[model samples]
Target: MHDFSWGQLVNPEFYIKLGGIYLVLFIIFAETGLFAGFFLPGDSLLFLSGIYSKELIQEIVFIKSDFLNVLLLSSLVSIVGIIGNEVGYWFGKKSGPYLYNRKDTIIFKKRYLFQAKDFYDKHGGGAIILARFLPILRTFAPIIAGIVQMNKGKYFLYNIIGSIAWSFLLIFSGHYLYKIFLNNLDFDLKKHIEIIVLIMVLVTTGPVLFKLFFKKKEGEDDNSI
Candidate 1:
């Protein structure tokens, strides 16, 4: 954990730090904002990285580490997150139908796609925001949005709104929380990063597992049907 997190989360050198921000941005885009990015970290990492942004302002970017800067970084994260998701929507539109269902395993686990499709249908465009908070659903949200051929202008509007709310709330929350606790002495970088990483794993993965289980159960019922 010590060597694991670079200046992004804790402390480190120079050049590596520059790459981290872009990487985090890219992941946020690919994961929540993109199709295949469902495997990427969403809320948890957003929160953890949000905290790191505060630290970044204080040290790296030289952007006075104050509440004002907090707002700026938070807004930046949200904007980037939403932008990433929009790009993902395009990607999904380009590729989703061909991958909608498996030929051999039609009934294996169609619940996610079906649910995502329905949600996108009813909500119009706001599903983008809802999906940001839900990792597995985030992956499907944009794809489904595309599949439905949602109005491009409306989709962008909703995506920006959702991304701003979701990204700022979660990441800034993480940033503030980390600030409150870690500011004290006896700092534990490894423990801190480890906890954050663990949280990311759970936030990203736990829902996936639960969805898989429920879908499996649904599959069994369909088999019985």
Candidate 2:
């Protein structure tokens, strides 16, 4: 087995280098479906998958065209993401009540689950789609859908739409934008991947953090006053 440091675990590039495309698919699966996967790098990993599309795609299949390879990779990732959500929904449906009474552990947090519940309540079925872009919410929204016993057909429809949109948008952005920078601006995303990943994390997780800390605290203060 390959030894992975904590830093390496968090780095999107390390995943690609360590296990290539297959590892990427597993990480996407875990992050989207498992409660313990809430902290995994989702958006940045998808973005980096685009940057390394050629190399990663070669592992599974040989494609002559770069665009087609990225497209194929994105499609595969979308399918895995959809399956992951299905697993999460099934888990929630089976043990929805137990989860509420379960205490927090290193990998599990009641707050994130509650946050997902509120998001689902407010947005109704749309939360499944919207939560695909949000970090913790994305991880738990499907589970919440199952917990509430959302219509199976409706959940499936939103799951497909959300997974496709999320996978295609981020992965394609990385692939095409990398080409644009290299050809036109003489910039290489691969060289500056650290900065790019950092930005992606901040952009994707910023709102969740803001709500968790600032907004929640403000509400507490208001209640106290």
Candidate 3:
């Protein structure tokens, strides 16, 4: 089996060449659990990972590959994601007022925390589920929920449901379609991977852009009034 180099893990150009499936789990954990991982790519990673499973077993992991394995991977990813968010929530709860009172820096911003709080207040418990599909919001929602002292039982339920939905929707969808179009597609998939990833990023971020625009328009109307 082909092994990836350590350098590949951090290199943006070769980020996908990290320690196979382990890297996928790490990325999911970091993105959901750690504040520093706010910039990590999530949506495209899930989709591409699912597609790569078709060959990863034969070429990299060196195991028998099948859709069942992909399903297992998705389940593992979702479970890890749930754990990550749970950790985030715990961290937020433990940090408590320290985070609230901290000054903004290049990496840490009070505004982000405030925004997350505002979002949580507006959406209530549902934000935990909805935020899974969002980028920045997803990372901060659980933390905000904890900071606000939302019910643990409710949070857990939402986290589990959201993780399952997000993982299956993106990862499984990619694997399923890859199988269907394995021979039917005429284009060079390898050549278009970059484009495909770019599209996924845009699609995932679309809602955030829409929300910003709507908020701006609302503010304009408020000023006019």
For candidate 2, the per-residue lDDT at 173 reads 94
Task: Give the whole-model CA lDDT for all candidates, comma-separated.
Answer: 0.67, 0.87, 0.76
lDDT of 1: 0.67
**Model 3 poorest 10 in a row by lDDT:** 7-16
Off by over 4 Å in 2: 1-4, 97-122
- Top TM-score hit: 2
Clashing pairs for predicted structure model 2, backbone only: none
TM-score of 3: 0.80
Rank by lDDT (best first): 2, 3, 1
Q: Which candidate leads the pack in lDDT?
A: 2
Q: lDDT tens string, model 1, 26-111?
A: 66767756456765556666676665675644544667647766777677677777777777778777765665654437564556
lDDT tens digits, residue span 89-205, model 2: 998888877877899999988787667666666675678888899888889878778876667887899999999999999999999999999999999999987898789989987
lDDT of 3 by residue, 96-141 (tens): 6888788889998878766766766677567788888887778887
All candidates: CA RMSD (Å): 5.4, 3.8, 4.6
Off by over 4 Å in 3: 1-13, 55-65, 99-122
